[model samples]
Target: MFELRHVSKRHGAIIALDAIDLSIAAGQTTALIGPSGAGKSSILRMLIGLEWPDAGEVRFDGVPLRRETLLEQRRRIGYVIQEGGLFPHLTGASNAALLARTLGWETSRIEARLRELAELCQLPFAALSRYPAELSGGQRQRVGLIRALMLDPAVLLLDEPLGALDPIVRHDLQTQMRELFALLNKTVVLVTHDVAEAVWLGDTLVLLRAGKILQKGGIDELLDVPADPFVHQFMNAQRRLREDA
Candidate 1:
């Protein structure tokens, strides 16, 4: 559903992504994984039109992503960033309904959608009246997911959505999200630093470092035949984490 072809991005003299190419298919989940400054989030920025590539192209469906079509494209893409990105003043329901209301959806329609999402995410309907500060970390992320899915967008881009939660909570949400993805059948692209988390949520994993893709495949492929010493090291680190878990 999305493609980045030979994409490059730079900030002044520093490169954020260098000739990175990725393709996300419909009804599948792909994870971008790496260490800090690996340009994992840069891919999402370009995909969402938040940042432009210095060279190459980013396409949604079959059309090139440009400023002219960005707004329209974004309406069809659901984005959930770290910590929910909720407005503290707004209640969970308000936050979730923000986009739909802005788009002129009826109040009844919004409430009905919220109800469905509340059940889908296993969040309480009563919690929708609470503010972000009042909700637990996991609850806030659920609120964020509800907000992102409010419009029923065709593509979901999640950037470290479960990064701040406790391990138990993160694990629970991961299971829920796995089921949700299969249920929704939407194209999903997730950016995360945790290899375990990536493996839990993604069908395809892309390992990156120094702003370039090092390897892209299943977890077993990465473990079986690493591209280089760095890939081997990276997979080993995650294996240790898995063992500890």
Candidate 2:
């Protein structure tokens, strides 16, 4: 499990994150939803050790995050971002196997892992030979996901993973992602602005605003019993739209 205890971050005079406290369970998918500059990405970054907190600590499996343990912790966490974060010059297979090679995994083992992840992600075998430029947006994102999962990380952090794809592709990838996460049983933290996406993909939804947690719980819990007017309005808008449709 991942725990954030009174975690706060500041940049000069700007407070990027307030005294935030949250717990993320293993093998569950949690979506962080909010408007822009709400610090959703900041949370993800802190988890991956990209950004250090000015106060408090981020703990994984009861161990506090520290420089001495950063590398090992990172190796156990997978991160995906917009644009897939693939190397344009490398083939999909090379990209996926990069970490394995760096970790001194055997050639045969790397190939086997690539094949397994490709199958699990439902990516075509042909895509392994293709460069990022030659693949579609969805395909690139799939490769990016495969790269992250290549090591079978315990936790996956996704920052707007579907933001760059077209609607059709986004929907398809979303479905695939949910199924993949379920099968893998890896803890997932997804950051997105799309309300519907959050509802669809998350086992639990965390709403944030201005570096603070507004609400966090199951979708049904929030919908049926909102904490305040903002949540009430947000839930009602979806409910009314669905009712009208």
Candidate 3:
């Protein structure tokens, strides 16, 4: 559903992505995993047209991602960032309905969709009436999920959506998200620093470091046939943490 061809991105002295070629399949969950500054989030931003690559191209569903078609393309993609990325001034309900309202959806339709997604995300309908500061961390994330799914976009792109939550909330949301992904059967691309989370949620894993892809495959493949020594180190680090903890 998404492809990157020799994509390179730079932020002055820092290289965010370095001519990396990758493709994300439709109806599958692909996790972008790595340590800090690995360029995982950079790829996500490019996919959603938030940032452009310094060189090379990003394509979605066979078409190049052009600025002219960006608005249309974005409407077809759902994005959720950490801590819900909510607007402080707007209530949760208003935040979720922003896109649909812009598209001229009826009030009844928007409310109905909000309720449906609130249930799907395991958030209470009443919570939508509250502002971002009024909701808890978990509620904020759920609100974010509701906003992303409000339009029922074809693809869901999440950049550490649960990273800021407590462990219990994060785990519960992860379980719910796994089931939701299976139920929706939509293409999903997740960016995360947690290897275990990536393994638990992602159908395929793409490990990156220093702005380039080090390996792409299942966890077992990474364990048995690592493309680079860094891949094994990265996996083992996660395993060791769990074992030690």
Candidate 4:
């Protein structure tokens, strides 16, 4: 569904991604996990064309991502970031319907789609009428998911979607997210720092560090035959934290 070939991206003096090659399978959920500065979010941004590689290529459905076609390509992809990335002034419904409105969808069609997605994401029907500032953290995240899934895109790119929510909300949403992924069967790329979250929700895990991929495979493979010491430590970090706690 997506491919990054020798991709290198730098933000000024910072190297966000360095000559990394990756391929995300269609109809599967792949998690990008690593520590700070590991380039997980950078990869997600590139996939959606918000950022471009300084060298190498980023391809979607076999076509190289180009500026001229980025907007069109984006319509086929849904993306959500932390805290929903909602506009401060817009109502949750308005934020979720932004793309459809831009595409000239009718008001009735937009409202109908919003109703469908609100239910899918398990968001309260009345919450859509509230502004971003008026919603709780979980509600805001749900609003974000509704926005991302509103267009019924072929791919979903989530960058730390649950990172900010409380543990209770996060746990519940994890189940919902997994069900949604399986039900939708879209190519999903998730960026997270939590190994347990990645293992639980992802079909495949891609561990990165300092802008390079150190390991990529199933949870068992990563746990049993880690590519490096960092992979082993990272995969077991949750257990280690528990033991220490």
**Per-prediction TM-score:** 0.96, 0.95, 0.97, 0.95
For model 4, residues 13-34, the per-residue Cα lDDT tens digits are 9999989999999999999999
* Candidate 2 displacement at residue 139 in angstroms: 0.5
* Candidate 3 residue lDDT tens string, 1-245: 99999999999999999999999999999999999999999999999999999999999999999999999999999999998999999999999999999999999999999989999999999999999999999999999999999889999999999999989989999999999999999999999988888888889999999999999998789877889999888888776433322
| Deviation in Å, model 2, residue 133 alpha carbon | 0.7
* Candidate 4 root-mean-square deviation in Å: 2.5
**Alpha-carbon runs more than 4 Å astray in model 2:** 237-245
Show where candidate 3 strays beyond 4 Å.
240-245
Better of 3 and 4 by lDDT: 3
Clashing pairs in 1: none
Residues forming the 10-long window of minimal summed lDDT in candidate 3: 236-245
Off by over 4 Å in 1: 240-245
Determine which window of 10 residues in candidate 2 has minimal summed lDDT: 236-245
lDDT of each: 0.92, 0.88, 0.93, 0.91
**Alpha-carbon RMSD to native, per candidate:** 1.6, 2.1, 2.0, 2.5
Score candidate 3 by lDDT: 0.93
Candidate 2 residue pairs in clash (backbone atoms < 3 Å): none
> Per-residue CA lDDT of candidate 2, range 64-182, in tens?
99999899989998999997899989999999889889999999998888888889988997898999999999989989999999898999999999999999999899899988988
